[model samples]
Target chain A: MNFLEEVILKEGQALSDQVLKVDSFLNHQIDPQVMQKVGQEFARLYRSEGITKVLTIESSGIAPSVMAGLELGVPVVFARKRKSLTQNGDLLTAKVYSFTKEEENEISVSKKWLKAGEKVLVIDDFLAHGEAALGLANLVEEAGAEVAGFGIVIEKSFQSGREKLLKKGYRVESLARVASLSNGSITFTRNGQEAWSL
Target chain B: MNFLEEVILKEGQALSDQVLKVDSFLNHQIDPQVMQKVGQEFARLYRSEGITKVLTIESSGIAPSVMAGLELGVPVVFARKRKSLTQNGDLLTAKVYSFTKEEENEISVSKKWLKAGEKVLVIDDFLAHGEAALGLANLVEEAGAEVAGFGIVIEKSFQSGREKLLKKGYRVESLARVASLSNGSITFTRNGQEAWSL
Candidate 1:
């Protein structure tokens, strides 16, 4: 977590102190060794959860989620944001509202991948408004699988994602929790760190 | 490579005997253990290539590509299919026609991640038309990076991807090559395997 925080401080771009962009290390451009560590941290957190599958959204979530799956000795099932030509089957679909994209995307997972009674651990890179996590939980339920828990690399605590999931009775773990990103600065809740400007 | 070949024979779904669906383990629902083997295989193959980075596209390629990145101790930079909200920078773009989607998509990579003179190893899940690999190669060149080679998990040998890359003078390595997928039967180039039906 400290390493991740340090990397965020160094490489992550803060957009107007409101949006944290990690394209350099987390999402678009990836450091798989660091991602391996993130996955190991998640595995350590959910060691006794009996996780069978690691669920995530397509594109950005695949890296950290798959890393967690490898560490947990589980398979990773990512919900496709759009139906592709090669993807043909009965799918579990859920509507996810992205605050950043300002739209609703119906993400889907093939029914063949997530089976009934399987325990799923949802993983993603960032948790902002909890839409993706909730949507993935919906997909898990549609597959007749149970949501074991959720693992997130970064959490914007000023946003209501964590609180929403916790209110929904889901155990959510985020490695880096940001208290506020106001006025071109980032503040952490637990570490009680100074507000670092971009 | 034999392990991958065996897995393709065992779990890979034969769609119309022409389209091989590896959603069970490779792409949709990923078996990270198998992907680890895939990463190891790539590392073993490109041991002397001095690969500084692993390049892949979004969606399916992230898993094996990042696995290879972790194994090879390099960063994985995946090309984004669409420009997102946070992505605001100069990009190296390439046009890829998806034979599956029946459309052309312009994939872009940030100019920051891929720099001049870096050794890049391209990785992907499937190679059918070779558009993705070719487009990635173009992006690499645009970034002034050299494409060390390309690594594919599965190759539809009946298709033109392999021959095209070979013609382009790129060293391509496919873990499993299906020579024919006629009449719902899959014949491997190396193993001379059975023709499976969905």
Candidate 2:
């Protein structure tokens, strides 16, 4: 299995039947080496997309966004989660819901950073609900930029996040995808160990 | 004068007499190229300190912490600012007062990531009020770890944050120190232009 898939299987905790807590390494307690490699993998995956920038939200997504930006050699712009944003120039905004926090927030980006015709790669840690990625994609579209694709660290495929995104005709790639979480056992989509090793 | 100092002098804005907004490159909107250089400088400064890990708070500090971790080739752990953290083992927490946000938050780190006797290099984006850095240092200490030093991207030297950290006998280094902010002009600690070119 790839290092990321292996790490998730070995270190990720299945809390209850609905949650996969990877805070020990992927999100809360970060392993920079592993995160950097994740970025490199994303960069390799999106190398031909002609991505001009990497975009994400604050907090958890910052590390992976920075690493991917460094690997892609592009500036990274993160949308700040705010209660509200006054209508202003050069600002693109959208509403997003946080499944983990169970709260909705307004995410926005300035017009100066994201320009017309620029291709953006959205990088985020989790894809449970896909609201965050969708919000960011909306922001890019509002800025008149094209979303090259999305790079997510972990995707809960049991949820409709990926299917929704795919139905909308957006390209989405995830490093480690969980197909099902039954009782305490977690099943990954890419089950074969070799699927991860390469 | 350092490269970061130069960029601050050129791009940093003085919103009020007490605030120097560096959203153009540091926090809100990040310049990865510049941040990578800042990390290199910090890595060079603390090369002999025998630092085992890098520590910082979440949100703004994540990018710089990750970059610094990459340069130092160490793991980076961030403290999460929550209204409360359920008292539990495998967690080291501290109370930090935010002068800007006008609130107090309980920041915690997983004990699994920080170990007793390990030297930690604290990296942050700013040193305003020093509470964040000091709070992170407290987390390290609570984990029974040692603080190697603090590497800050910007220090509001006009405030008491740096002074407070210094009084505690902590080795604190800042890439850009704002000596004074009068009207709309900012005077950097490194006054000469050559200070930045170096």
Candidate 3:
């Protein structure tokens, strides 16, 4: 297994079948080495996409997105979940429903940061229901920019996030794909097929 | 002037006598190269402190903290500004009041991420009223850890943040220290003395 897949199996906690908490390395408590590798992997995959800017939602998505931006020598723009006091400019916004929070939040990007005709790569930590990626893509479209593709850290194959994005004609690259988290065990999808079932 | 100071002078907007908007690079939209340098600078500043972990608030603080963590070969823990569904465990929380937003937010770090007696370097994007830094320090103390020092990207030197932290015996290193933003001009502090009045 790849390092990411191995990390998931070893460090990731399966709270339930629907929830895989990777707070130890991916989100809450971050391992910078893993983030660097994730950045390199994303850069390698999307190197030829002519990406001009990297777009992501705030908080969890910032690290990986910034690493990829550094690798690509580009700027990274994060959509704010809440409007701050100093946020001044025309804003590009979209509504995103969070499966985890079970709520809808309006995510926004400053229009000044995203220019027309720019090729943007959308990045996020998880792909559970596709709402965030769709929202971020909507922001890029609102700015008259094109979404080159998406780089997701972890994709839940049991969910329809990937299928939905694929149906919308978006290229997606997920470093680790989980087929199932049944019986308190983590099983990853390999070669688009079911692999070692723990 | 350093790269960060140059960027602030060229790109930062002084909204009023009290607010300096650096959303163009530091906070909202981020420059990866600048962030990389900021990380390197922080790592260099705190190299001798024996920092076992890098702690910061979520969203804006994640990038620089992760970069420093990568340089230091340690884990970076970001306190959540808002709670999420999967955040389960004993939590170490502190209430932080935002002078800009004029609201109070309870930032929380998982008890599991922080261990007693670990040396933590507190990093943040800005130091204004010292509320956020104080809140983060409170978290470190609550977790039974020792705070090595603070690494601030930008500091409003006219304000009381540095003085307050210093009075509490906490070491602070601000990369760009703005002496004043009066008359829509950015003036910086050099060697603890006011300099470059524009």
Candidate 4:
């Protein structure tokens, strides 16, 4: 978490009051070594829950999910936003409302990919409004699977995402939680039990 | 390669005359162990080529790119299809035509993440019409970077993707190349010297 926080501080760019662009190492352009460490950290954190699959959305979440999947020796399944010709009709679909994109898009996963009673851990790059996570959780539940927990790389604690997921009684773990991004400065919540100190 | 071939034969579904769906393990739901082997194979194949970065386009390409990046110990940069609110204006953009979706979309990579003169190896899940690869290659070139090679999980030999890439003088390596898909039977091109025998 320290490494991730350091990387965010060093490479993440701020684009106004709400957006922090981590294209350098976290999302668009990825640092594999750092990603591997993050994966190992997630695996260490959630290894005891008996996670059967790692679920994520398309694009940004694929890298970390793949990394965590490798460490956990589980399969990684991603929900596709766009329906391609290769995609079949046998799918579990969920409608995700993106606050940023300002649109509601249907994301789906093949029912053949997710079993009926598997334990799934959801992973993603950023947890802002928690819409994507909730959507993914919906897909998992649609398959009659259990939500073991949620793992995120960077989280905006000031947002309602954490509160929303916690309201649903889902255990969420994030590597770096930004307590506040006031005046273009990032303040990360102290990880571990010290998170209570914030 | 044998493992990948076997996976394709077992789990891959023939959606139509041209589309082969391997979402069970290659794209939608990925087998981490097999993905690690794929990364290792890519690393072994391109280790001597001095690859500085792994380049790919999201969302399907992110898995194999991360795998290959883990093996090569290099960073992975994925081109995003749409401009998100989090993305900044500093980007290298290109137009890509999606045959499956039947649409044309713009893919972009942040300028801050990709540097000039980096040796990049492009990776993807499928090589059908080669538009995505060509779009990624265009982005790399726009960044003033050199493409070391292209690695694909599966390539439909019946399609013109390989020929188009070969015409561009790119060294392409596909783990499983389907010669033809007829009556739900798949034929793989022999490895080694016979691969080019086509």
Candidate 5:
């Protein structure tokens, strides 16, 4: 198992078959060491892609994405989540629905930050319904930039998020692929084999 | 001049006498290099404080605080901003009024993340009217923890934020202290002297 999977198994709470709470180390309370290592992992994976910038949503995605940007020696641009439309007209906006929050927020990136023909690497903490990932990709495309790939921390392979992104022809790399979270137990896929339960 | 001040002069916008826009490097579009340096400076300033954790507000504060936590070998916890009180009754909440947005947000920290007698270094991107800093300190105190000090990225010294924090006996260290933003130019405080102007 990777370091991330080991950490998840040790501290992650399998709240339900659909919800996995990693508040202790990932989202609410952040483990900087874990984030640093995760950043290094992302840099290792996408170093050859000629990524110009790292894009992520605000709040949860900032930590890992900034660390990855630091490792890759690129700037990090976070899309701000606004409940309403901002007054700025020079913004690349997308509508992202949060399955956990059950709300749709307008995520926006400033036009001045992103340039045309730039290769952007998108990063996020989780991949569930892929709404956020799709929204981020939409913003990059709107800026006339290329979405190089996505670096996700956790992927619920049981969900259709990963499949949807793959079908869209975007390279998605998730460090921890969760196979199951049932009966308060967590399981992972081995060597990209989803059928290998636990 | 410090590196942060240099970057501010180069890329930051002096929107008005009171408003400084650092979206290009510090907030919306983050320069990972500058953030890394800022984190190191924060760690250097507070390394002797015996801080067990780094606490900051979400979104803008995550990048610098997480980097400082990594340098100090501690966990970084971010308080989540909610439009209203959350359903969880175990959170330590504080009321913060934003001058720029003209909104009152109740920032909450989970009770499980903080422990009694632990020293927390409060981190924030901007120290203005001191509402956010005081609210962060209130959250730490509510958890029975001690607020070791405040690590701020930018401080508008003309505002009452730093004075209030100091009056409350909190050590406030800002990497870049802005004395004025008048006439589309930015000035800084030199050697703790606020009289130095551009």
Candidate 6:
């Protein structure tokens, strides 16, 4: 988490009060070394939970989820944004609004991949309004799978994402929680604290 | 390579003449152990290239590229198909035609991530028509970077992807090359040889 926070502090570019661009090492361009460290942290956090699979959305979430899956020795399943020709008809689909793209899109996974009573840990790069996370959780429930928890690289605590997931009684663990972004400066929550500190 | 060939022989699903779905381990649902093996194989193949970075496109390509990057102790850079509002303006962009989607879409990478004179190895899940590979290659070249070679998990040699990349003078290495898919049977090309035998 320290490595990730450090990387964010060093390389993360804040576009607005809400969005932070980590293309250098987090999403677009990835740092495998740092990613491994983050994966180890996730594995340490949820190893005892008996996670059967790691679930994520396309594009950004794939790298971190792959690393976590490798560390946890589990399968990684990603929900595709667009329905491909290869995708089977039996799928669990959910429509989610993307604040970044300013549009709504559907994410789906084959019913064959997820089954009943499986434990799935949802992972992603960023958590803002929590639409993507909720959508993934909805898919897991649709498959009759258990939501072990949600793991995120960064969370904007100033937003209502954390509150929304917590309201649903889903445990959300974010490596770095940004309490506030004022005047282009990011303030992170104190380490190992339930409530974010500004 | 034998391991990969065995995997294809055992788990590959042939839908038609043009489609072979291995989403169980290669793309949609990723097997961590097998993915690690793939990373090791790629490391073995390109270890001597002094690869500074592993380049790939988003969604499917991120997993293998991350694995390969981890094995080789290098960073991975994935080109994103959709540009977020936070994305930096200075980017290397290329137009890619997706046969599956039946449309042309643009992929881009922030110029800040790819430095001039960096040695990059492009990795992908499938190489059907070589548009994605060529698009990635174009982005790397535009950034004044050196492409070490291209690594593909599966290449449909029956298609023109390999021929196209070869004509561009790229040294392409595929773990499993399907020489043909006929009558619901898939044939793999022999390893490390230009001449493919079913």
Best by DockQ: 5
Best by TM-score: 5
lDDT of 4 at B192: 48
Q: What DockQ does each listed candidate score?
A: 0.82, 0.71, 0.84, 0.76, 0.88, 0.78
- Cα miss at A80, model 2 (Å)? 1.7
Per-prediction TM-score to the true structure, in the order listed? 0.92, 0.91, 0.94, 0.91, 0.96, 0.92
RMSD (CA, Å), candidate 4 to true, equals: 3.6
Taking the tens digit of each residue's C-alpha lDDT, what string does model 4 give over A105-173? 888988987877899999989899999899899999999998998999899987889889999999999
Q: Candidates' lDDT values, in order?
A: 0.85, 0.85, 0.89, 0.84, 0.91, 0.86
Which parts of model 6 are misplaced by more than 4 Å? A83-88, A191-198, B82-89, B191-198
| Model 4 regions more than 4 Å off | A82-89, A191-198, B82-89, B191-198
lDDT winner: 5
Each model's interface RMSD (Å)? 0.7, 1.4, 0.7, 1.1, 0.7, 1.0
Prediction-by-prediction clash tally: 2, 8, 0, 0, 0, 0
lDDT of 1 by residue, A96-186 (tens): 8878867778889889888999999999888988999999999898888999999998899888898889999999888888777777677
Higher-ranked by TM-score: 2 or 5? 5
Model 5 stretches astray by more than 4 angstroms: A191-198, B191-198
**Model 2 ranges off by over 4 Å:** A83-91, A191-198, B84-90, B190-198
* Models sorted by DockQ, best on top: 5, 3, 1, 6, 4, 2
| CA-based DockQ, model 6 | 0.78
Pairs that clash in candidate 2: A1-A193, A1-A196, A1-A197, A2-A196, A2-A197, A90-A111, B1-B195, B1-B196
- The local distance difference test score of model 5 is 0.91
Q: What is the Cα-based TM-score of model 2?
A: 0.91
- Which residue pairs come into collision in candidate 4? none
Clashing pairs in 1: B185-B195, B186-B195
Residue B146 Cα positional deviation in candidate 3, in Å, after optimal superposition:
0.3
Model 1 lDDT, residue A50, Cα:
91
